[model samples]
Target chain A: MSRIILYTRFNRFWHWTQALLILLLAVTGFEVRGTFRIFGYLRAVNLHHGLSLALMTLVLFAAFWHLTTGEWRQYLPTRVFLKEMAAFYLTGIFRGAPHPVRKERTAKLNPLQRLAYLGFKVLIIPVQFTTGALYFFYPNLNAHAWPAGFLWGVSTLHVLGAFGLLAFLVGHVYLTTTGHTPLANLKAMLVGYEEDA
Target chain B: MTNMTSPSGPIRPPRPGRFIQALAGLMVLFLPVLATQPPPGPAHGAYGRVRAERNRDVTADHTRFKVLQGPFKDGDGSAVTRACLTCHVKAADQVMATRHWNWRPAATDRKGYGKSTHLVNNFCISTLGGNQEACSRCHAGYGMTDRTFDFTKAENVDCLVCHDTTGDYEKVKGGYPNPAVPLAEIAQKVGRTSNQTCGVCHFFGGGADATKHGDLDDTLLKAPRSLDVHLSRDGAAMSCTDCHGARSHEVAGPDYGAPADRREQPRFAGEAVSRMACTACHTATPHASFVLNRHYRKVACQTCHIPAYARGGLASNLSWTWSTAGRLKGGRPYEDKDANGLVTYNTIHGDMVWAKNVKPEYVFYDGSMDFTLLTDPLPATRPVVLNPLHGSYADPDARIWPFKRHDGDQPFDPVQNRLVAPWTAGPKGSGAYWGDYDWDTAIRLGMEKAGLPYSGKFGFVKTSMWWPITHMVAPKEQALACGECHSRQGRLARVKGFYLPGRDRAPGLDFLGWGLVLLTFCATLVHGASRVLASRSRRNP
Candidate 1:
């Protein structure tokens, strides 16, 4: 096996922490909406706020680390093989087809995977974070400073980001079950190891 | 074809089984992620439970009291009184007090009071009749079946009508059919009904008995302007007790007299006390006019409209009355006599004054309105003596005169102590002071001077004065003005866009809401486009 280092310890830490925070956010978000009460509302809200702050800090750290290491290049999108990747996920994956692009030590994610992850990071995450931040600090902001319309717009955008995240989660859960084995992907996330092709 | 067959083989599809396996793994991981995460706790649980229980109680109570008590007409043209009371028997008193009990035929005979002789006709009853099932569905209560029930007993409207007892009833007693239970047991078995119960009654087409004074349809009820105070369909619904609970049952008489004893008759108990009613839904400032201008706070509604006591009697209209004779400590007469062979004794009767003394800064009335008496106050005359022991008597006329008073310093303005205005500008013998009030002119002038909209109906002369008086009586003229109360009816007529007389204008939030939507859309578009462009660049690079 060509033992080329792909994910560093800090990278893995950020990834896992981010994933946990996102999960916590989803749980607390839904609880706030009153779908089902798992944690008491007050506790859920407290935890939600705490986790949101942690997520923000982690994001800041990750951004700094990425900028410092020039690793933000990992998320640079490419049109090459994008259509093929989409097709593979939609249809070919169900028919036992091979992946159009493969992961290597230097190129850890395929073109489509990179694009999707970049979209989530740059677009969805930022939108949610900014909107959420604005909402929390809304009272502190000068009421007449921002156009009243803008505040409303930001709130709507935040809600849309929430919906986008939800959609991603659904697809993500489905894809997780489509791993080499039912437990394979899950084991990898927990133990920080995956099957080498 | 030859090249395809030559070197590389056919493209292989992804393994479906592997994908399924990965998905299963993800779900498994997700499950633990949820499990390890603590569940939402007590506050959320309590809120949920209270919300649910409230809904149940309200629904149960509404169905029993308002919906089922009908002479519901089925499609087959037959009347059917549903058996809602078969399950709930305790809501009888609640149903009776509500406007629903009198939802029968309007008294068509016009001879009783000067108005139409009939007690007000419920729109539902007038249009749908007691036999219509569709009408009965919303007007639920006891005695819904046509042939099986008596309308007189009002047996259809029973207790547990608005109260939902699904969980509590099951917990307290084994089942709902247990009749050999104590009142306390039944009471304990019940839980508080939510705002949902109120919604059930207050909802679209449900409580819209258009013939009634307070009837509001769904369109009016759901208008944006009505959001703060109006009952929402899905949001918090207020309960009957929320507005009615300031008083309880033990209080007697509509006069608001002091309770005989706290153990026997509690003060503020429910027996048609309007002040108690006002305090229930309103806090911060209870009296509408008095809250804004504190001068007229001493006068209560019961003081002017004499309350008639009816322990086990039928309903009666309020009339004016004045006490004539003063009773001694032993319930005997006290007398005073004068030296000129004239006798003057202690008499309780006083002159009728239309407007009570209030601060001039707060007074809303124009000076020209007529102050004619509608009904003469009772007890016209009494014998009096200046000195009772000396046996000198005098004749005294004790007629109650309804006269208008202006806002001036009490016991200071010469006009305040006397019935007549000292200064008169009208021509002599013109009868201008004696003429009936020109209410429309007065109201228009008053509203214009106050900088308020005068778009409401001056339908009749009595109402013109009455409306203004009611407005003046409200403590806060700014928040609870004559226009606010009258505007409900006026708005339906499309009169001035739901303007309340005294309230500071509410900031419209619709534009803000729309603006938010557009902003969110643009943000999402930018975010998605940026991701797409980044992905393309990476692919090329």
Candidate 2:
């Protein structure tokens, strides 16, 4: 086995920072929902706003790095080995099966991984952003043009999206352990290096 | 160059100590003189206030003038008023038209019957005939003796009852002025009516002090800042007329109590007169919280700001049952007092129940009330709504309002199928209910005077009258909390207009949410366990 550069310095930094922000948002969001008592509703609202703003700033920097470094192409998904990767995860992986696709700088994410990451960026994040932004700006939006139940509907959508994101997080964490060794894929994301499996 | 102070040799900065020392010496010499001067009088602050000197806008002085000097003490108040009118002619006509002088109003807003005119109350019932003199004691006029008392006669208007600055003046059952009050002195000292001056009648209206309104009483005369920040002598020092502006003798605000609608609360300067409202001084949006401010569109200012009424240790009557008024002891007229020391039973009036720190009943009113008047047919089986709140949650102009709902019983004509007028006041021989203790004779005289046909058979009808509350404002910190209206036990829990989040929930939604969360956790645990078992089986094989 040989080690190679799979994650860049900026990429690793963005990943960890994004993880920390999502954690803060989830805790504060649940508090606002009357699930637990941490900071009061008012303080929790303020902190959620601040964290969201920070996450937006981080996203801007990460988007620029991805475009400039040509790493944006790593997430572009393909049909190659898509069936084999799904089958391996469903059954063969529990029987100690081999990975259907290889990981390198050129193709960092396998086909299924590429599909999940792309869908999350284009679909789930945008829904969360739109719903969250609308809640914060509802005051500025007057009542004449909107329906009476618009606010309640928006709130429900945001909470549902949060649950979806939490499920994705659980799956993502478990899949990272499916590399050649349990800690190999995690070490690559942490230290910017991956060993051939 | 050496004369240039040996450059760079211990650069010492010039000190201001000598100047300071000289200033201190001068201060010591002037200290005694400065101490002798009086310190400035207290400036206005949150602690309270002192009344500002009255600003008299008019330039005329009647006391020194030659035209006002003759026949001042002669005949009745009319003679004095005739002299007063020589200079100010239109004043009597304006005073005569007001609800104060007439003891009646032509129209109450856009509603059908006037509030004080033909519409009867659950307390003391109708002031139609025999009760005229008893009820008219609070009327700003003199000699409204019977139905025959002329409304056209300007002499009947008592200007001094309101304008007198002496505060000793009293108007009794016959609308007769207290003979002790010197008419000449009252005529001379007539000015803006003090709170003490108005309370002479208003505070003592409805047969006693604080009996009619839960928010008003003698307690407001020297109210502290905590009791009333606006009217307190130690707070804003505002007079009644300051907030309730007067135009052509009409006071700007709700005549009975609360403003009809939000628009009536504040009128643009010089615009047509309307009910004076709290939002006039405190703008509709006064709170820093956008959530609380946004509530102005749907909830009245008083509902949140006035956490309680009758908070000044003054009791306000909540109900009066006229059916119980006939109780007597040993054939003599009797009386009893409630636990709160309010009238429970009396020979003339009936049972009265009162309360303090009273929680107001919430309702959505759009200003109009279906006032039960003499002319309207009475509801037989249902509780007669003397004046019910007229709007619902669906009304755009309507909002949740606080009300002091007085509930009791009044006599109704079973034959005429309408409300009967019962004479209630005067000396016993004059045929009042108090004098004769005979509802038959009293109703006959009352119906005859009011020109309404008596049924000859009368029964007590249960009724409820509402007074919208706009006073007894509590401090900002004491205002109703967010949870007060948002929780299950909140003030608005029983309000029927709209759905509330914390106070209301659909059981289906709750069950569905719990079910979905459980399914997710169970699915994860089951799938993970099955995968682990299969991995071990493969390893064993």
Candidate 3:
């Protein structure tokens, strides 16, 4: 077994912050959509707005850091070990088989992780931001030719995007338990170091 | 010109008050002594009372004006109007040009629109027949017993009816001031219009207090804060004229000509348009919650602000059935009262239903309305709207408004397929409905007067009249909550053509979403359990 620094201080901070923000945003957003009423109607709306702003600000700062430090290259998709990694999770992991992929100092994400993260950044996040901004500026969209049901259409898409993100979160959390040990990936994320074999 | 003589006889010359002038001079000489004195104590009540009276909004007191002081002669109100016209030359002309004078809007191309002409309502039907003499008591002018009463005569205008500070002033038949009203005293006490002045006619419209418009009634005269935030003495303490400002005698209320949804921001420093709209004082986004403010585009402020109307003790007339009239007991006309003492049945008015604290019906209104005239054909269906408001969900200018829907079953001419105006009040043996208690005679004579052909056969057709509720705004705490319209069976459930979040859902979407979540949960559980079992076997080996 070998120990290495897999995450920097800023990376650890951004990951936990983004995770908490996403969880809070989901709770408040679902409440605003009338799914539940834990925070009440007005309070839910206020919290959702505030959390969305925080998430957006953190995302911008992370983007700037990734570009400046060239850390964004870590998420680049590769075909090597892609099928083996899928097979390891599907059957081999239950039979005490070794993982096909290894964590290196240069490459932290597997092919599957790269693809899923790419889809989340390009599709789910964009959809949420675009639809949410449209809803915020709805009263100003009083053009004569605009359809009456425009806001409803935007809201429906926004809700669908939220469900997609929620499903991704469930899968992502479960995958963290598939490291060398059950709590290995969680401890590494907490301490900014990974122990790999 | 012959009627232009002053009925208040002649203005008397004022005598000099030498005693009052000498007292004022003596006080001025002792001004320094008074300045050194301490503030008046509670025991010196007269000084405090005089100081409080001095802090009023009035620019000039009518009592001090030389023109108003009179030992008036009273035969007709024209004498009092003539005295007023002496100094205010253009006042009568401006008064004559208003809807208050003509009972209709200024020239519109839309046919059958005015109350004085072809317009008809479910309550008290029409004044076109010989019923003008009875209805003219509410007219702004005097001697309007018939349509032939001259409109050009400025002397016919009665200014005291609207400006009288003395609540004692009343109008008798023929729109003339009651002879016992002490007209000279009221004329001298004239000031800006108040809730009492406007309520005198508006509150008692369909017959008595709280009979016509549900939101307007005697309870507003000295309203408590819970009833109305603006007019309540304990709240803003505003008078009626504060909002309905008169610009050249054209008072600002809801103009039927304009669109209902006013998208303008709050009034600026010197804005030319002085509308009596909620947006005139409040911006469209007045709520602190941005979600609630978003509803301002489609729903009116009144829809949420006024949860219910006709509040405060008085019950509003909800329905009237003229078919049940002419019922007599012991060979004499009688009346029946409900448990609340409201009239349920009257020989003259027929069956009546009254309700208090009524929840208003919701409808999309664009402000303009289509009226059913005498020449217009009646619909085959009953409960036809007499003045159907024009709007729809797709109309951009339309907003969902609250209304008090009054139902009625009034006289109709089946052969002509039109509504007929029956003379309900006149001298005995004059073929009036109230006089002879004969519908046949009343219909025949009334048709002759209205210049309409009648079938000699009349039936009562069910109809409805919609009155917009824009008054009696409750406190902000009383405003409707989000769940009230966002729930499954909430207020906006009946409002269609739009999908609400909590009130509506797609079963297919919900099923798919929950199924995906469940599958993910089961898959993770199986994977975790298998991994744990494998690790246990490895350790044992």
| Chain B TM-scores of the candidates | 0.27, 0.82, 0.82
- Candidate 1 vs 3: which has more TM-score: 3
| Residue pairs in collision within model 3 | B7-B79
TM-score of model 2 vs. true structure: 0.76
lDDT tens digits, residues B159-243, model 1? 3423444422110111121233232333333445534333344332312221111122223233221221222322223323333
Query: What fraction of the native alpha-carbon contacts across the interface, defined at 8 angstroms, is recovered by model 2?
Result: 0.08
Clashes of each: 111, 6, 1
Deviation in angstroms for A58 in model 1?
0.6
Model 1 interface CAPRI class: incorrect
Which lDDT tens digits does candidate 2 get at residues B1-541? 1122334533222223543463355334323322322443342543222333233355667578665454455326676667677777998898877766655553655343443467777666677765676777777666776766787787777877778777766666666776655667667767766777777776765667777777778888878766766667666666677666677777654543344454444335566444356666577777765556867766888898788777778888888888877777998898888666766777767787888779888888776566678878887555787886777655666678888888888887877788888877756787878887888888888888888888689988888888777777766666786557755567887896354434544435445554565566665566567667877888787
Which of 1 and 3 is ahead in lDDT?
Answer: 3
TM-score ranking from best candidate downward: 3, 2, 1
TM-score of each: 0.31, 0.76, 0.83
What is the model-wide C-alpha lDDT for candidate 3? 0.78
Candidate 3 Cα outliers beyond 4 Å, as residue runs: B1-75, B86-90, B108-112, B255-258, B261-273, B283-295, B323-353, B379-382, B426-431, B434-438, B499-507, B529-541
Best by lDDT: 3
